[model samples]
Target: MAKSAKTKTEVVAETPVPKKTRKKTEPVEDLTIAEAPIQLQAVENYSRFSEFDIYLFKSGKHFKLYEKLGSHVAEYKGVIGTYFAVWAPNAHYVSVIGNFNGWERGSHPLSSRWDGSGIWEGFVPNIGRGEVYKYFIKSMNNGLELEKSDPFALWCEVAPQTASVVWDTWYEWQDEGWMRNRRKHNSLTSPISVYEVHLASWMRDPDNPERFLNYREIADSLVPYVKEMGFTHVELMPIMEAPYPPSWGYQITGYFSCASRMGNPQDLMYLIERLHLEDIGVYMDWVPSHFPGDAHGLYNFDGTHLYEHADPRKGYHPDWKSYIFNYGRNEVRSFLVSNAVFWMDRYHTDGLRVDAVASMLYLDYSRKHGEWIPNEFGGRENLEAISLMKEMNEAVFKDFPDAQTIAEESTAFPGVSRPTYLGGLGFGMKWMMGWMNDTLKYFEKDPMFRRWHQDQITFSLVYAFSENFMLPLSHDEVVYGKGSLIGKMPGDEWQRFANLRLLFTYMYTHPGTKLLFMGGEFAQAREWNFQQSLDWHLLNQAPHKGIQECVKALNSALRNQPALHDYNFSPEGFEWIDSQDRDNCIVAYSRKGLNPSDTIVVVLNMTPVPQQGYRIGVPSVGIWEEVFNSDNPSFYGSGVSNTQVIETQPEKWHNQPQSVVLTLPPLAGIILKKSAK
Candidate 1:
């Protein structure tokens, strides 16, 4: 038993270790060679793939089709050219047009494959990097033509420009030492304190205040902030190519391309490389549940619901006003799975936080009685989407076992983090949305009434270990009149600070990994506005400064201690000393690690009145040292704290062999551990 207390795999070569040169695999089709006039010389070496790819793609298992289906620059025969291809099974004709070809659809037409594979390919000589391109596709169903950006583009023209750029994703990584040993830092036993950030709003030019920081600039700034704050990883909101700024990168148009709002694709690589070098794993929000209905995007591609469901009830997302992916389609599955792998393969991301998983798992999520169509089994479960999720998770773990797949699932979807073979979703972890909701709601109420809601605080332990979980105080909690973390507390400024500090202290001691959105660390006064930066000036205020100081101190303890994090997923790591102390609005627990001596006692007092003689059980008989006190003066507290050391009594208490009478500060928490000898 970890006197218990309590969190970032398998593909070896497929892990995408960077190298100076890559070996050519197979020849991809070249439409110029097949459709060009006899006098027009074709770039023969432009054949970047083989019929084997078509065979694999046909079966929907082609995970690297991005290598063949997008515009890529390479040497075919003797001439260097940009090879272009797209999956338009229902297109009558697909042409590659851009500034390189004078935007004339007829200038560089693609040749359809003879095997009825629905893929069109061609190569344009003299075209190279930095050139903008888009596919002019003629819909086979409606005979209507549409211009669409490459879904597999590595980079794109910064919004509001909707053009794909012929770019390369070659970055010389220097985090080799970090990548090779990431398993140690990302494992279940390791502490995972994630700092969720929105690149656009995390910070901005103080002088200009309007210009967004570039990826490199953020590396120089945000990277160090996270490192100094003792975060183990940085989970970014969707940085994928998105046009709408207010959507906050959630409604994505390009899965493969990083949002051009920040920088080019290589710039994203630089950002990831920087975070890795700092020993911080990088995780990005990946939205596979639904896509926007933008005309330039996947909606009605080829003049039909090619990427979405044919039925509106099954295809549309009423909540986000978007279109859902047709996960049942083999080609769509391949597209999504390959995109998931592409990040790990090309950008070296540590994990993906799958967004809107609840919507994907349930066909009737956020839908009224008749707004949804049931599956073939006549149930609420989305069978096709469930299959795709399993397959995606399987591929991700198979290719990179150490890499993580986290589901933002809110339902009682059993076994979300369990392996697929075990009849689960195969995710590495699931967001603890229930815990967040319950706990936050409990804390928001007045402490006088907290006794009536003790179940909210103690109920989490009932199923805390059912799935590997991440406790997230995310941006969703403090946006659009939801108020800031501190604002939710019901009291004067001082009590608010105390409650927020106590809340964070409890979160760190609880089971599961940790994730905190930006601004919550310092208790930013205003709700998060995606349009502007955080009120960083608040750091100068004593109360707000105290909150930040409390976070830093709490993070220090969370990082240095083993008992607090080593066994978070198992019941052995955590034991309730007095969970039924609802009358006093207090709870006591012990966190244990693998080593017998690695034990920490935690006591929380939620009321305004301090408990001077709070007797709590201790697993060890010795002098229990006060290692941390959230009520210390440095944290903007009233200086109410216990002496450094207090010896345990021999009398039994709370059903323990040993006990200690300690002063529990009002609206605060304290951590104690056995001193040496």
Candidate 2:
């Protein structure tokens, strides 16, 4: 029940009209009176402007205003002493409590004066750097007591008892044009395979479980492995400072600081610098959707709801049990936008993979059936959050055009990776979740059931064309009860090993850029556990050693093949040749470049039965040589199939000009390159 009314304004002034007499009507033109300056009529106070109109104004005028405000804020940069501000509409008094005051509450009360609005401002003189503090607010309405930290704190440090640390220091980046060069060389699918690894669990010295390798140790050891593996990028899973152990770095406590537990800030920068020097791109997992629940963290900072919404319904996430940010607020938006810029500008990181974007896009995202409310228009979308995300993307692209921002959204939200100008979420790329799920489901089925599921592999192309996608074997699918990729096979040990080889070969040959999680290449025997180290000894074992060799070979082949890299970004790059026989477990596909001369055909057999003289169609009529084979004796395979050097017959099968005959073996894959056209 909202009320609406309009009020009319009276004329304030009248202009004197001059009386004119026209003799004989010289060119008698009818003069119409101009509308009276569209009189200052008041519309209903309850009525608000349209969201698009507001956005237009904000994007133009408000941004200019913020630029002016930023200039004002910049004037105090590096000037010592403490300048503090708080927003507590419901609180009467707010005091600064911290180590600076010997942890006393009343010793150094923040002298805050309320503007007519809820905001309270104060400045504490000579409160130098590295001081930890929280706010003590007295609730006016309920007389409740509350303690909070600064929501916009650039740095916070409290020992073992407190979770955050002060990390406000300057970084000097020497790689001035490295980002530009990287973007120019790398595309959505330019052989840009990524090795996704969690730094803490990736390596642990046998002598120390509590004491893991620092950033320097990781860079020295892991970078060589990544370089040898031939992955273009290294995606770290949430390097931001967090509190919980075994939490996979998702519950971030410090938004602007690197995880201090790993190493010092300089060490993290050194890692990034080393990676850049090695010509490997680094992508950070950025989680701006939510913050941790720790009292010392972002929650209730500044003795009020500064970062998050004041309303619990809007602030709390149901499933994760975390606090969501109020993106509707301008300061919050600026903070996040600046954070993104800070990482790229300071660290020289090439890209970001934004985590849990679906959680940020909807109001009722993870809520139970009856616990959520819709907008006034009866839609469940959180338009304000969407707008903020869009603005953030726009800001990132404008500031750092070379840096990519990838989305980790699982929902079927259209255009999550589309350009912002196209009325979509502006992500450079998005995880191909549907393709991964469908492919995994197809792979998990028995050979007999695979015929019906074969379409799953081919049919994904329909939606895959919509956005740039990464074929990710992310950390999510490997850890916990989900089991490792090798553990998901449907056969004996040898068959399982062969199935994994087939899977990897297919993955390497797939159109999208691939991401293989740590220990996946070596075929770790058990599922991944965050608490324990990856089975490093597996590299010594013969079976696992063979898998690693195959991985290396596959990575090498992917890098060398022109067809694989040239047109790998487009729908036309991939063509399914055969999926007809499920019992025999044979699937064949081909990749072709924009130049017809560059072409490659791959055939895989997952069945126990070996067949001689198997004919598979090729995309070109030319001599086809075996470029790679997963069943080679060096890879610990049975080597039942002949190492055939076949020539394609002059035939146009399935619109292609070639067909090659080869011997096919159980649990093997063969990659063939057409002879030079």
Candidate 3:
């Protein structure tokens, strides 16, 4: 077994581990699969859990703890009620308070099991779904009374209203074909062009202005658009229920519930089903880093920092004004790991992009030198969170091999996307923040000054394959004063549009998967506003419309061209033809598939000056066709293009025996494939 993150000194439980602690996890063998997740519908006396169940939970290896702990509706003795269980170790007393009992605590007092598991449970007969409820707890530590929302809530009330609704997983899914063949779409070599979106702001009723579309509506609108643009996946920003809107769903309150602002859990399921049917995979942006310290949320339970740390330095997140989970605790790991699998098993989600992973990996993230604590090894790494991430990934992958877990980590943490058994974090992919930063820095510079800093663009290939990287120009780059991507270009109107086209061209041809935030495909001039809809009217203009058309073409080519997507993670797929040509600010490269005949040469001119008869090398001395041109009139460029074919010369150049003279358009990228004989 791997080392647990709980330090030898800190004991989260009220009592220390017993003699069975040193023994292997043999207690869990006592419980059978029959005891797991069967909903009841009668007056149930299922008030106590077996010691074996609690033992497995205490070991932090029980992946299905959600079914045993949270509210589960069932029929027992012909009485239908919801079974409620909670972990509040420090509380002297706990009760379920809700509208069913007129918010009275005495109506549904819970009993503490005698097993020392620190769990309380009770069943209420004749009460079922849609009832608002909260846990009223009297703290043994301070006598402070607290009423908190359910941590495992399935459906929460809309923002500004705090209540947990009893929801049933009752969606009839029609995505069996998608679920069966998902491996073909989620493979490392598959073309994964993700369109990132925030549901609330993605669109609103044009006439009403303040009304956001629900899940079903988005399926009708967002689904077709993604399919038409040829994107293979759609990565949604967090849809978890939150009290604050500007937090953009990051300040999570209900870790288990989908945001009710969009509709019920079933409606969200419908949206996912539609997407899967269309062959578009769905990835949820899952936040397991920190949660806001809202009064009704997970800040304090049992009034003793049950979910977080008592120490401010360890528990508090200064950047987001939230509280970090005490990952060293066994139950906390079970909660997080169970939540990850819940989405994959219950909703058929293709992947989870773990958000704010850098903050979770390091102990001193965003803190002053003296304000943070080190791990047991006296290092900055937070071993507990590392263990939790590994378990989450391991659990998700073990059951659903077609699913994936991606990391949004920014630091140089080694082996972030590697398998866990190899002494690494078990993640499927990681965002390429360095590439996004370097590429944007190069593009934002003036064309005249860009040649002086040509290394900025070429430096990314140095460690591009360090992980299974996904090149993301995500929502983070478009909001909070960073400005829209097109707005950051250092040029006039026409030049900026041209630069934007060139940037997308380079992004698609780069050696990684792709993700673009909403509105970027159409060149929305305004920055993203969570409160408002995307500026969809921009499509009426020629420049913005042209950018949209170019993106469509790029996505189509990225999916169909095996040479581009076949060897995405291997460095052998890419070879530079002429990267040292800083004088004219032009970079040329070739991409290869498994077969030598599958080859495409890409050339880019960063400046506004066109170059005619610029010689570029090729592997074979044959005709090269201009397959794609960013300078085409469809993209609103200068229209300097090669409409005809050119034969390669026998003269040697750029480490290749055959070369071809080409017309390189200004501020453009062109793709030329070997002619089909």
Candidate 4:
């Protein structure tokens, strides 16, 4: 009875043997379908996909296609083997080609389903997981033949080798406590300070810089470091398989495959599990906007623009030199949405930060006049893409209610973060690109001229509450000739470090969740390089070390202080105490929690000149103490600070009931909390 083949429940409920501990899996020895004891079956009686599955896939509602469309190891009758299925509607003939058959085409072919769903599926006996394979497809339209990787593969060969590996998403997860209570951690009002990391370059082996750290190795170091840094979450730059390293994982070739450069599917799961065990959430960047035109990728599958649009004006991305998905197509939408859900379901990712959302929403993104086509409504909006996003977000929230879907949208599209029922796009949060741009531009200018640019810094507050926002100082700011965050500061070394510290202080106290790129926390002095590790040696220097300490303190405050997070998405959480002090290059604001007693005041001195006895408004009549100061000597700032608690007098200032006189340090930020009597 073929050793009493394992049931589907048994296969998935238990962990797959790890690569290191399992017996070596090699190409089938001198085996071909014609010479084997068992033959391929046109699986109908033992088919994994049913009629309803095909209907759902054709109608673009099959969000769980991974369970049916991919190569799954199973037993047919009493023989153990693997079942393979793929979607190539334009293909006249399709066959499985791999090392098992000496890479010979037509040795074993798949059968097209009778349902007219354009799906090809079959079960080949005597073969199981760990087999490397690709599909040999002959186009029905042009007779064009090509080999393509599986779109629903769970794992692919490490980049530089374009072949899919038969694998399973089985792992013994130990994050029950985290899974049960992640709703509060991922809530809109919770503290969500994300540390964006590019896995390849974040750290590399010291002895062999060329070798990438496997997922388990990364978990050993990343979990402890993030826990110590006090970041609530770690946002990984896309870990999906992409051939070109320079694309930084945005150019995905395998939608459902884990980047084999790191490790197998289980290895990546272990990394996420480690983070969740430490109470830290994981957010993966998902790219549905476009894909690279690699030979084996989704560009021209089945010798037709089946995955992308037929028209170059609608299909191609000029800026990125890639192909945009045909979001209007039902099957293509099913594929994209299924990929999004696959990660969250199989990998236990806490959220998906959808990338290049602005490009997806606009038909004329980066195109000149006469180079683009308008939507049916004669507008620039890509209605099809918008609908796909709404559907994707709805499916994600429906299945995983505690999970979040963030958007990296740059344009001022109305309600990018609002719910779909309210005529919005239905994302959990949108990147505050305007705030990131204006804040950087204002900080780049000399503090002497910041008075004239006061409006630039405060303008974000005007539309702050329009959507649930996440203030991002992301990887985009430190790459492609844009200098490092600290390098953008305009001053001597001492003043530059102070400005960086001040930037973090103001960002934490701002009215939004925060996201900072990897190296920015310690003030790396150079632009980001994907090929190498961060400048970790900079920590030995006092100024760089101080910047790290300041960021750690800021993250601690963001996580522990309810006033900083409770109303981050609402106007009730933030109130301007004194924004009209631009002459002194000063601004003060109050952040409040649900309870009025948890109010905290923030003040910033943009210039490198101290002001003693600077009066600021207070919301309560009590002694207010300095809770945090960026000017502390430990952060490499001038030691000017308010050393004692100051009693608020019964004076009306800045529309507040009480006021207090305080010392303002040069080029620094300070937080004041009223003490309980």
Candidate 5:
């Protein structure tokens, strides 16, 4: 025993190894609970430690470490104050670099401390209000250099590089009281009748396509026209800052800043204010799905992957080739949430039509098989992105209770417009993409083919209850490879005009909110091109002007008739009376609820052959008076129908007495009024 320690060292050095004494080292057995207590305890400890490690891993402790490092930066909060924060987990030193700081990186160096988990923070006072800034960070790990802009920047204004300005300044809203009053009487009706337009292309000078007018100019030129056309809302394409000239503002570079190329931010505010003054609501096209591909822009603005996640699996939108924001990240969530608040609060926009919702809803959205990973539970992983959208809608509704948020979702996702707390996306309305596609296809068919297509128009009523819908002839449907709405008609010019008029009438009367494209009222002959001006000169022609006048009258009638405005919000408002006629093509429907005593029946004939004594089934037989005829000569069509006088009829069928037997002309529609008096 006394010689054991010294002998072990000496024995190892001097003694020869004995084959019998050299017992083979046994392989360690995997410890089980029933095994020896010491070994099992060690295994138990390891199992517990492993679980804790996994909890931290899935809970994003590593990501939080990055966040903690950046929280110590100077923060400004106010109506116009800039809030600055940075994320430099491994940075030994960080400084503010921006125009406000004279583009200097060293003067106001950020102080950072490792919180044991690799996070550093320091605050910079008075650095945010309209002051453009970036971070100059020095990495302690390898001296990696990085200069990053404020990820939560309300305004990032960099000329020809990043266009983000500090817009922390507040504006005095003179119309707050008016807005409150308007909210009291607002109704959620279908057949939304939206007129989508790009302010830049809507009315640029033909002589100079680039010489666009200011907000005031456009307001002055377009307000009267939109108001007269009876559109309930105007859906302007994205007015946010974008890089590409012909992107139609889809490739948004600035999330908060209005398109400076269009005009100053104040100009857009004035445009909305003026539209509100005209009693016409404005819905902005908001692209929250992805960012532009430009490097100087939102994509990786920090020189490292800050706004976007590091993994291409999570950060890249393959379809758009754009940078996808990490919705699962808090700072990124704050950035987008604040951006949404910025629009509604600053611009006073009545609503937002959220673009490309379907693209945002799926993790494997627009991806081929085997390109994406399923969630941990193995179902399609839309949880994180869907949760972000739900939060967005909730915040928007909570802040601006009266404002609407509409979704452009092509997929039949359930509860898209339901309250977020109800396990659904909280949207005020959803674009009836199905109704638009089905209705357009139905209208484009020949009368001989229409019978097969009539259900497309009528059957939409089945799912109408899912969400409040807007029947939009959106910019997407009228541009690029898609022909003009009028061009989609399967007939000659006159028949085309007739088809269009009938379509508009149906759109206005259908069971959803309605949206028409710019120049759709006058049947803009050309497809919408963002690079070119709308054919405003077409208005100078008689046929076009007549169509414009008809639109105006339709708007007036829509406003005047309580039947149109009252039940417009309800699915029960629209009831199809005839959906099964192929020969002599007649479809009639009645809009109920606005005025119970006074009902409006609309009958359409797309056939070229006129029918004599055409008996259309009336909901009740009363002296049905012809209220509106699309073929009235006053509207630039053959006056083959009666005038706009109220008709009285008694119930005839099913205990109804008053049914009118009249000749139906080809390519004509008649709106009849039933007077209970």
Candidate 6:
């Protein structure tokens, strides 16, 4: 219920707080009004925007809109009040509404900027931190009235309560060391073992299964576990505020606000700060492709489809039943780009993994013929989206040189991870979806049939270095009736775990960065359910413990072994030693670094039968020892390993000058490193 009557605007001025007493997080509501009050119109004498800001915002170059557009707590003319700004050009009238004003629409109307930027702004006294509010907009078109959440809100009320909150980003960050030297950790050449997690489901209140652990609680548990597990970075699933938990944070309503269900903005910052302190980088999953069509969200914003396209073909997403963004619009581009930059700028995120990129790149993605409109050039490419992506990437890298942008692009779009100056999309990395699909397909088959389909495993190297790639066994593979990674294997319990270990070893040794979904590391038996926590009880079993230990070892090897990561994205870093061993259901390769002494050989045995005295080619004539064997007893593997270091012979095997004879364990992968000459 709201008051329908319009009221004349008014503002009250009071003595300013001492500069020394002012703090960003100080609640403005605590201030006492002066006895002799000075009253003025609510929309008069206060503005946070400058002429240049309007110019940039109009021309779509304003990437830091978070500073200009959101509701910011400020002291105006010696009085503490909140400054509100929103872009709703189609609205004839816009007013602030919330509990503070008794949901009165016309009591606090904002004035349009004189610069024709379509930005409505004003200052309201006594509206301070923690006040819930929404824009009550009367659209010029058909006098349509809408109550919409602020797109640039720094915080929002929890789900089932959609009003935006007046808040500030103030946190004492203790991650200076991490921020100063993050380049090395987030470098393309570094060993980036990302553990992708859905925060709500990663772990919950053990005492109450229905409750989600807040950001601080998650930090206490997740930080140490990831540190001990040896992952270099943590890629959190979309954390933006979404009304429905089933959407899993993807259907973002508050683009700039962290999900209120988790905690406030500072709470999330604390979690990220703790991670950085632990030397772990954070990657946020960003979704600029489509948004859920909620009434209070961007859809039909201002009752004019302001944030989305006017046409159904270009504006709607068929697959996800969401509304696509109007990338062609300048203001929308500025809003989207600003949202991307805000995370890195304010949240100190190390990277952005752009989600559903392929869906954004093509004009007819998931649509049949005649259902999509071609670009002006009569091409199927989404030219506007392409341009927006380039601008977004340029802004992200230009502002934060150490940060990276990774694309979850499935199609063969050229130069997705290349530089924008070279007609590329300018991402630092792209997920290798082909590799994940092929590897999983090969592993799910009976070992006897794998030899016939050797190309399924070897096909990835054909384009491994085409663009910077990250092999991802993500959560998508284990949801919606899809079985768990372990359950995907075709074998008894022991063999299934063995296959998962071998799969992980292959991924780490492969020529790319690595990403593993939460439950995959330990082989959680059931499919992922966003509603419940992972089966932590599964760790009590020996096999599950074995898989977890195997992943830890793989991460260690990926980090410590230079040969595995130094040239991971370069052809010079890899060589095929025995790809034609289809008869033996085995594939072997060598990894090289700057120094020849840093070379390592990897061999994978796909079958259950051990190969006694298997001869694999070596790059150098020296003593080579089994540095890591997946079949070790520690990982619950059948105890089979080459305990002795062997000197290579001038055997001219597999086109190499020298070779070594070693015992290959059944259904396992092993790493060999040459000893110092």
Q: Candidate 4 on 453-551: residue-level lDDT in tens? A: 999999999999999999999999999899899999999999999999999998999999999999999999999999999999999999999999899
- Number of clashes recorded per candidate: 24, 3, 10, 0, 53, 1
After best superposition, candidate 1 residue 194: deviation in angstroms?
0.5
Q: What TM-score does structure 3 among the candidates reach?
A: 0.93
Supply candidate 6's per-residue lDDT for 213. 97
Encode model 3's per-residue lDDT on 358-439: one tens digit a residue.
9999999999999999999899999999999988988999999988788999999999988999887999999999999999
Query: What's the TM-score of each model vs. the native?
Result: 0.93, 0.83, 0.93, 0.94, 0.81, 0.94
Q: How does model 5 fare in lDDT?
A: 0.65
Candidate 1 least-lDDT 10 residues: 1-10
- Show model 6 residue runs off by greater than 4 Å: 1-45
Per-prediction RMSD in angstroms?
10.6, 16.2, 8.1, 6.9, 16.1, 6.3
User: What is the RMSD, in Å, between candidate 1 and the native fold over all Cα?
Assistant: 10.6
Residue 97 of model 4 has an lDDT of 77
What TM-score number comes out for model 2? 0.83
The residue-by-residue lDDT of candidate 2 on 72-143, one tens digit each, is 111123333454544455665555655555545455444323123334433444443344566666666665
Q: Which wins on lDDT, candidate 3 or candidate 6?
A: 6
Task: Indicate the residue-level lDDT of 112 in model 2.
Answer: 28
Alpha-carbon lDDT of model 1: 0.85
Kindly report which residue stretches of model 5 are placed more than 4 angstroms away from their true locations once superposed.
1-94, 98-102, 111-163, 184-186, 189-192, 301-304, 643-658
The lDDT values for all models are 0.85, 0.69, 0.86, 0.89, 0.65, 0.89
Segments in model 2 whose C-alpha atoms lie over 4 Å from true places:
1-97, 107-159, 310-313, 640-642
lDDT tens digits by residue: candidate 6, 420-498: 9999999999999999999999999999899999999999999999999999999999999889999998788889988
Report the CA-based lDDT of candidate 6 relative to the real structure. 0.89
Q: Which scores greater on TM-score, model 4 or model 5?
A: 4
The predicted structure with the larger TM-score, 2 or 6, is 6
